[model samples]
Target chain A: MFFIKKNWLTGYITIVVKGAHPELFFQILAKHQIMSWNIIKHDKETACGRIKLADVMKVRQIRRKTRYKLSFGSRKGLPFTMKQLNQKRPLIIGFLVVIIFIFMLSNLIWRVDITGLDAEIEEKVSQQLEEYGVKTGNFQWNVTSPGNIQKQLLADIPELLWVGVKRTGSAYHLEGVEKTIVEKEEPTPPGHLVATKEGVVANLFISKGQPMVQTNDVVYPGDILVSGFLHSSDEEDTNSGTIVGAEGEVFAEVWYKSEVTVPMEQELQLMKGINEKKHYLQFKDIVLPIWNFKQPSFSEYQIESEEKDFYFLKWKLPVTYTKKTIYQTEITKQQMEAEQARKIALAQARRELSRTTPPKTKIIDEKVLHESAENGKVKLTLYYSVLENIATKQPISQGD
Target chain B: MKKNKLKESIMRSITQIFDLPSEVTLKLPRITTIGTIHAYIENHQGLIIFSSEELLLKVHQGHVRIKGKGFVLKMMIAQDILLEGEISGIYYEK
Candidate 1:
């Protein structure tokens, strides 16, 4: 289709052949290989048809022998249009210059877009690229090879698993997939297992090394529960033992003692009611707040505040809405029994024990003892027997 | 004329027995029309007459006259002519 249209644009002329036998003329034209189409006969002696501009000259030379009066009907095609355009030379030159300018401009990287990265990571990568002379408005020819840039990015940005750089027209697209890093555990050296607190050894499960203390043996902090060395049996080779890292769990009856005193009469504060005040600030995520007044107006009130930041279209806005609820309170005095004071002291000691115990420790037995109750106050002591891991890895001292 | 008819009948029989196209076996003109809008004439001799309303083309044995409204000779080469228009009637003159 383009070929035909191009030929039409190259110019074709319609010509009328007035002769006795127009069919003979058509036959002759076809024989000469002169492309002519859309032939319409007016009568027996006259017909009109279109011939390409190249063939018009050939037709002029061939018409002398046919005795046919050739008259051009209409001239059309790019040749005539170009002939008219020849009068305006500067306009054509300007058009050509504009086309060349656009072609050249498209070859330069005018924009750089880095996607699929966290804000911190994107900033670091952008700074790295900028340092490497890769930025917007850099010529595509002057840019380093994408493979080299990707390698540099992968090495410099440890969190990036894969990096890709693609140039599309005037834009450079940088994308990466984040790496999931798994931390390697450091090797634990040969060590002894020591007690971290005072306890009676209830049971011992040792996987390595020799047990220095038996079940029901009372031990204190710094006592070696298990030895890291094995005694050498050979008489001549006499080393103390083969040292290894001690590994095991030691369940023990651990005693926790605390002295807590509670007065019989005390003053307690209670919340009577609550009032809330809310404020909202709307801004872009890049903006920061310089001042925030959060002081409560009431003297004997507690203020609890919550902040909620709004996100629009997945973009975090600096806009934060804060809600503060002021809880009003009143103070009153009351009297308590000695038994009640003892119980409160016991609960306080138990809470402190639990807070100090390791997360995996299990309490098997507990006892509360009222040491004294006098002078409108009471004192109590508490004990807890727990099962826990006491295998403290202590690297063997090289000097020994 | 009688001998020519006998030869034509022999060729027609050969075409039927061999299951070959009649255009290849009998040197006949192939005329294809798409409804009343377009037509293609293959193995045509030359143009006899042409106009917007009527077209006459020489074929193997005679001439084909097509009367139509807005007749256009869309394409013309050595032995093929593509015509497009609202065709009213077609006639063959021997």
Candidate 2:
């Protein structure tokens, strides 16, 4: 198309000339309708305007038989001049080449795609995406939501600690870190009130086991909550001489301490905007992407994206296109004063001590110890050695 | 004086080309072995219902017609198929 439109105009309508004589010659040609005059200039070296055939440049023309012409005249002055640019070459050719390259390179994918998997117990992380809308030959958001699908899959299977879904063109990638759940040990057989914490009995409640402490008694950590219901000493059976133990509850004093630390810098998102572009490629599969072209952000910001195909065209292509947001954010760092830090530290200590201490454990006293402050950061240490009478009891299944 | 065989042949040829709606009854083979999106209709009929597979149904003035995934009329021969008021037990009548 370009060759057809612009090539002829360059070939016949214009020509380059030099000097007053050649200029007059081109003017004659123009008058005779043999040439349409385009460019006439004075400065022979640097180009001022379009060069016509009359413009002077070192060239040669074949006349009669042997043409030994060499002088600055025009392209006609050159010995054997193939088609060469006059002067507007850079502007015309540069625009054409740049436009062509940009258009062609745009077809290449900048992202990959993966989405659509629905399974109960099975981790169809890859297969489900391939089933609904995840494959090569799709644009961003052409298949599945890369980031959201990754997070959802990870969340659904709590055993998965991490999942990374990325798009590299049409193909969607799914990398995951499966979570490992550790099992806990079972409780000891009941009947004996074993000590869970060592304590001077601050309080006591005996339901099935012996009461080892009284109220106002202090207790150490890991004293028994209650003795084991069955005593190893009482191994013998009934009448034959067996020492049988009774079942009950025992409340003892339990003590606990905790340490807390909060960093001065915290990142949080304040605002965000969304823009999405949809692309469909390949003969079959689709690649969908929701990308964010935005400013850089702090390390603490989290991003989310999603895509769902309503119906498929040709039984394979997605009929519906989805838009998502790739997010970039700046995390605002927070600075905390000494007062807030102290309060936060104390709260942390209380929560930790409360969880480990048995129920009904009272907080006797709490002391706040302010540590050294350095570089806009202050540490608050809470020496909360609490005195509480706690009863630790866990049910254990007896052998039938 | 007219040729009856030629008339039959012409009618059959016309049926094959314009009879795309009939081909809509034939079942589409499973798309993938993994997921449940097993079938898709090649020739689309206006009315479509979905359960396990898809069925193309057509309702006209007096006669009603149903085509499977490809084009089989096994149960449409005997009874009067009432598409409006939910009538069942139909066989290939036409």
> Highest DockQ, which number?
1
Q: Residues A255-372, candidate 1, lDDT per residue (tens digit)?
A: 6666788888889998877654645453644433334455666668777755544333333346655555678777777788887887788777667767887777877877775477
Candidate 2 is graded, for docking, as incorrect
Candidate 2 ranges with C-alpha deviation above 4 Å = A1-190, A218-251, A271-302, A307-323, A355-362, A387-400, B1-94
**Candidate 1: docking tier:** incorrect
lDDT of 2: 0.41
What value does the lDDT take at residue A197 in candidate 2? 61
- What is candidate 1's DockQ? 0.22
Taking the tens digit of each residue's C-alpha lDDT, what string does model 1 give over B8-37? 999999999999999877777899999999
lDDT of each: 0.76, 0.41
Model 2 scores a TM of: 0.34
Q: How many pairs of residues collide in each model?
A: 2, 92
* lDDT for position A399 in model 1: 78
Q: Determine which window of 10 residues in candidate 2 chain B has minimal summed lDDT.
A: B73-82
Q: In lDDT terms, how accurate is model 1?
A: 0.76
User: Model 2, residue A29: displacement in angstroms?
Assistant: 42
Q: In candidate 1, which residue pairs clash?
A: A41-B50, A230-A241
